[model samples]
Target: MAVHGRTEAQPIDLTQVRAYGDTLNDGAIALSFSLPVPYGDEAKEAARQLVRQMGLHDPQVYHAHDLGEGYTWLLVYAKSPYSVDFTKISVPKVSNHKLSHAAIEDYWHEHGGGEKLRVIGACTGDDAHTVGIDAILNYKGWRGDKGLESYKCFAVKNLGAQVENDRLLAEAAAFGADVILVSQVVTQKDCHRTNLAALVDLAEAEGARGERIFLCGGPRLSHPIALELGFDAGFGPGTVPSDVASYLVQAVVQRRRENAQPI
Candidate 1:
């Protein structure tokens, strides 16, 4: 949480707190969950008693529903009767360089950038899921007004689900792509590791290894892991188009400068 105002209240120490729920004035909490039981007044009372037994005070069952068959859902409000400090806590985060959309466009245009940036995206191997890849490449942006297609500087070719390694490389070479986005959803049996390594190996064999940026995305992919596997960067869940676009434009500009520099 970002601090915006000063208060006389002593800072709450969240690090030592073992509570998890909404902080109400009287330590009250409202929760919902399902149970495999028949719905009725008896069941509702049982749920209230269960909450009370779980250390809450004066548990009250506000609603209960029969979710067909024997499954029942219940909503309960109860007093947790506990409080804690709220300020002493911290979490690790990625520190990638943040660049605005205009900045990216400016950098690219300054460094031989009118040529449409070619990007190839695929869900490699037998991982037939396309949701992750589509989230980044699809013209219809996800979670608001943001996606790769929104950027006019990039020409993306998203090869949806179940793409083979050989096919991806062939297309990248054919398209003269400047970047390759690989999405690996199935990590079972370390298939993700093997597939990622194969792409890098193929790129090296084709002499396009370091000439283009290689990006990986998945539920489990991370920056450190992608770097270890020879990728330029990694994006996990919650990645937007702007994030990838920023990195690609900056990287392309830097590469152009390095190649043009006379030794």
Candidate 2:
């Protein structure tokens, strides 16, 4: 229990957590989807029955619209009968805390031993989008944060888009890269996953896997998904240049410590 002034608040049970709206433990949920049917009274009933089949109770179709091509969109409200144990959830995440652009620059300058961290970034494997990679590697970064190229601690070489895996690895070798950043914005047919996994495989084949850190990012990628695809870490939407900068410097420091090398 928590007390605020003279009032007390009940502790939430983590073992049976459910969605709440309008009232605590109400389990109210809103769902929206489209079906291949014309909008009518029958369409509303179909949506309600479909929600019931999904194990939701008291499903009420609040809105329906016709798409003019025999398609109907629906919005429904219902009560979810199931709950999840919040304590059982576990996720792999980047270990670095949020550091400001200035703070990261300061730390790297103080401990970097006069050596710049070399980073090679590209949008590999037929991906034409450069926005994600440029936001992290170019001097003109996304939003208001300055990118890695603007920092004195990092030596950045952005290879632009649609780079092949072997060429990217060759460039990393030639640049003596400390980190390799790959971005895949085109995810149609799971091509991003295929390309990222192939890059790791090629690096391993060339005995270059353990020499540098491999990081990938995209709209569809997450840290867990990146791990599954054999990347060191992954970034997704809304990630600023400072976030990647902070993670790489800290990761380099950690790796150097593990190998008993100077920072």
Winner by lDDT: 2
Write down the lDDT that model 1 would get.
Answer: 0.79
Off by over 4 Å in 1: 1-96, 261-263
Worst 10 residues of 1 by lDDT: 1-10
Clashes of 2: 0
Each prediction's Cα RMSD?
7.1, 3.7
lDDT of each: 0.79, 0.90
Q: Per-residue lDDT tens digits of candidate 1, residues 80-137?
A: 7676555654333334566677766666676644687788899999999888888888
Q: Highest TM-score, which number?
A: 2
Q: Please estimate how well model 2 matches the true structure, expressed as its whole-model Cα lDDT.
A: 0.90
In model 1, state the lDDT of residue 140.
77
> Distance (Å) between predicted and true CA of 243, model 2?
1.4
Q: Give a tens-digit lDDT track for model 2, residues 186-257.
A: 999999999999999999999999878999999999999999999999999998999999999888877777
Model 2, residue pairs in steric clash: none
Which regions of candidate 2 deviate over 4 angstroms?
1-11, 100-103, 110-113, 257-263
